[model samples]
Target: MSASLYLVAMIVIPAIGAAAVAALPRERGLLAKQVTLGVSLVVLLLAVLATAAFDVDGDRFQLTTSVSWIPDFGAEFALGVDGIALVMLLLIGVLVPLVVTASWHEADAGPRPTRVFFAWLLLLEAMMVGVFVATDVLLFYVFFEAMLVPMYFLIGSFGGPRRQYAAVKFFLYSLVGGLIMLAAVIGLYVVSTSQLGEGTFAFDALRQLDIDPEVQKLLFLGFFVAFAIKAPLVPFHTWLPDSGAEAPIGGAVLLVGVLDKVGTFGFLRYCLPLFPDASRFFAPFVLVLAVVGILYAALLAMGQTDMKRLVSYTSISHFGFIALGIFAFTTEAGTGAVLYMVNHGLATGLLFIVVGMLIGRGGSRQIGDYGGVAAKAPLLAGAFLVAGLASLALPGTNSFVSEFLVLIGSFPERPVFTIVATVGIILAALYILLMYQRTMHGPPRGVLLQQDPAEPLSGTGTGTGTGTGTGGATAASATATATRPAAPGTLRVLDLSRRELAVVAPLIALIIGLGVYPQPLLDLIEPAVSATISDLGGTDR
Candidate 1:
């Protein structure tokens, strides 16, 4: 397909699916779920096709097609993907289907659940793809803000008891950031108009304007604040843990895996290129915050009792590394940073899935709530461990390669910052291993052993089981028949179900595949990194 056709399909297909799902009768739960899942699969296939057709050595913006989206305002419905956007779109395509699958039961939960929930999920996917592909800054911002709606409802309506609180916090923080960015967007337009005798929100047109350095810094901050909040770099990061902890598994997956990347992505796509002088002026401040985030968030991850919150904190720490890689301004570090975005989504999304499984089976997010799960649910424990190791960037996992490249690359340009960020790695190992041991090791909890637990918990849907932690063994092995009265009230909890397996299996493969042989991904990333750093006049120190 042509680039315009390809880009249009990527955005429109899911939107059509969402509307279709929404129009279905409220009682058609299973059908609604199926339709949404099918749409996501189709999107995934489209992504594969796009990848196959991509020109490895081509213009920065390939498959680009533009038409005026807003002629009066000079904005266009222009869409394209460079190497950076291409990978992000692929990541979005991969995650949405798994998200629909993983949260199938969540979609089925409550009265009238599937129709609205699935629709929102698909809509979220549509907006996410739009953000990555839009070449018009105004168009990018519009999609950027629209992304919050579905997420807000997902968290508020479907999340934990405190879902409303989490949803509101997330919305308000993002709204404030968006408003700040709106000012910057206007400033850029004003600059474009003054120079060219007409206003335009087209990215290319705006880039040609020569705004005063002071004005550039002001506009840059407007955009940077928005991206940083989305990145959740430290003080700005508090909203993330609450949102991640409260949202349904699918929502949490997208929240961290895709939406948040917009922050760092903004840095790469907009900030660096649009305002070079401003970027240089702010580099040290951003660098300091990135380092602070690494240590501060890791320490908090060490202390979190809620499993999802811990994962969120760890992401904050990881974002720190991503920010460091961008600012370090070496080709290797920048490439590693972009690669880290993809790897973090896979590894951390895996962590969330495994943790969701544990919460489904064990009934609580607390670390001390369970033990001896390794013996009962080896597959579950193993999956959790692999994800944890990946979070810590263990060798032989996808994240390790990216993290190594970032650190090694940064050392030449920023030795001290690199040294401090390295400490985050050690801290990462501590938090992840400790979380694993506490949740997966020791004896199975009483809660884990149910007499006849009705059905497996799906997503955050309410389910009942008395007592806490499901660590205790059933005493009898599966091979032998029940010789005696099977202990008072204990039935074996199953290991990774087919649905859960379906979610993690693909991710597990990618985690290992990319970690072992990352050259293919790096090839796509290096050229873009070089171009960005070249703009900054930066090279290996």
Candidate 2:
């Protein structure tokens, strides 16, 4: 196959894999899982090859493949990747397999067909890859909206007790955003038709149109609102906590890690280059939202009882940082924003997976239910600590490098906003550290006091028991469990199984490795970011 087909293969392999997995015998769930994982690894290898073939100094978009589709609309099945898209592809490649590994037995938790769950995962992977790779606005929009379907099923069919509610909210929010974007997409095409005597949805062609400043603002708002809802900044973020808390762990990882990035990616890819004047005009307002989201979400995270909900809030806060970097109008901040996209995926994905493991052992998602988890499960505790530290952007974690770059780069252009945003780092420390202390550092409490809790526990759903009972005997038993020592046969929390260790090992390596040396990723990201800044005629004061 031609090298240009690499992106095509990346998308096709997973799609075909999904179909195959879905075709497996009902009893062949194990085979279905193995097949899905194998397919994902193959996609990862292709992503690596695509990355290796990408010349840093080459054309702005690489591995491009185009074919005409809707002639009347001037749309084509065009796909390509810039440094930003390539890195996202790499992130998608890395996370999907780990999710598969982490959620190895997630399907068996319900009477839902195991093959169907894995199939949705593979299908979702394909759509996510398409969203990043598409060079045509129409094609990108299709992938963008199409993504909701598989994820809807993944969450609604295979997720926790509140899955249906979460799924509907996620679908509705995304659908509304997509519909608004559709109007903007149509308007953009109309603008192109008037200027060029024909319509085109090609991203490169559209970006060059000399749209009126007033018109740009209108178009900008449509796109910005869509992305904001997707990124889920502040008020638009209400749906995420529910979705994250209710979805399966694998679904939660992708929901926050990759799906949410599309919103920020849209800001960088569409809002900036295509609407430069409007971008500058609206920068201050966008920054206001960004900083507000950071502080607000951080405050909310500190108050969460469900571990998944807390992690989701942290992502909304991190996205605020990404938005700040993008609107800062510096190559450094843009690069940092793009890098943060990848690093956030690594750190947050690992955090979700590890938290899922904790829920698995304890049979509960409530933070108060877990105490001194470190004592009972040292390896699990160690992993959670590492993930928490990374989420807080600790000095030697991957998040630190990206977060540092975003702050310093944005400071000069928007010092007030930058300073306000900086306070979020302190808030992040409070939330992350407090979460760690409450869950892992105290004496065993809640479900950790149950005998053989891990045996039938599936961390993907609602926990088995509520430790908070009004009964005197129950309260006394709980008090006794917390005060007294754990007996050899009582309240046993399992350490990280070898399979779980294998799952998180790569993410831990990347978190530490990239923390130490982010230059390689920066090198790959800088050129495209620079080109984007150049399109806007450099930083706006």
What clash count goes with each model?
10, 1
What are the models' TM-scores? 0.93, 0.94
Runs with alpha carbons beyond 4 Å of true place in candidate 1: 449-456, 461-492
- lDDT computed for candidate 1: 0.83
The alpha-carbon deviation from the true structure for residue 55 of candidate 2, after best TM-score superposition, in angstroms, is 0.5
Per-model lDDT = 0.83, 0.87
| Model 1 lDDT per residue over 95-164, tens place | 9999888887654543335689899899999999999999999999999999999899888877765688
Tens-digit per-residue lDDT, 427-511, candidate 2: 9999999989998886666653442433322455354343211111233343343344445435567788778889888999999
